[model samples]
Target: MPAPTEITVHQQSRVLEIAFDDGTRFRIPFELMRIYSPSAEVKGHGPGQEVLQTGKRDVLITALEPIGHYAVRPEFSDGHASGLFSWDYLHKLGSQQDALWRDYEARLAAAGKGRDDAMPGKAGGSCHSH
Candidate 1:
């Protein structure tokens, strides 16, 4: 995996930009990053245990902390600071943003949910039990 050579946080536009050693540049919206966060709160601890994240349409990246040389931990405005975005994950996010977004929308629909209907930076808390 290509490690990030440069990382920038655009607070004004609420985006995180990263340039990889392989020359790939990614500009990811903070909202997207928040929803896709690798934290156990979002991704869970194992396969099939993934949780659907919601209400993060207005989330912000309050800070980015470097974790050694392998990853970055982003502090969200909502106080979610657990996700550690590794280089490979970040690259995948940049490259597959559209697909991931579509999947998210589909999941929401299947769950009888809507992004606009969710409260700010919330998760599956509002989802009804099947």
Candidate 2:
């Protein structure tokens, strides 16, 4: 597989632009990345156990940390920082963004949910604090 030669996170556009060694490049949206996160919190441990992510339309990436030359860990502004996006997975997401986004919208509609529903009312207090 072609490894990523460069990755650019556009905060204004909320997309990550990746360029691979094979001359293939793609721009992936933040919403898509967050919803399809590979972490156990999102993907679950087994097949068919995926948790649908919602209300992440405006999630911002606060930072990016390289992981052992294979993946990048994105720290989201909403406090979610668990998913490690590998090269292969990022490529898949970039290549299939349209279909996946459509499916996500459909799922949200089916579940009577919207982007605003994924988080609590903006009073801004996290239960994760110790």
**What local lDDT score does residue 129 receive in model 2, on the 0 to 100 scale?**
28
Stretches of candidate 1 exceeding 4 Å from the true structure: 119-130
TM-score of each: 0.86, 0.86
lDDT score for residue 57 of model 1: 78
**What ranges in model 2 sit over 4 Å off?**
120-130
Candidate 1 Cα lDDT to native: 0.84
**Candidate 2: what lDDT?**
0.86
Kindly list the per-residue Cα lDDT of model 1 for residues 1-130, writing each as its tens digit.
7999899999888889999989899899888898889987777667766677777877888889999888899999988899999888899999899998998899889978787565445556633344
The local distance difference test score of each candidate is 0.84, 0.86
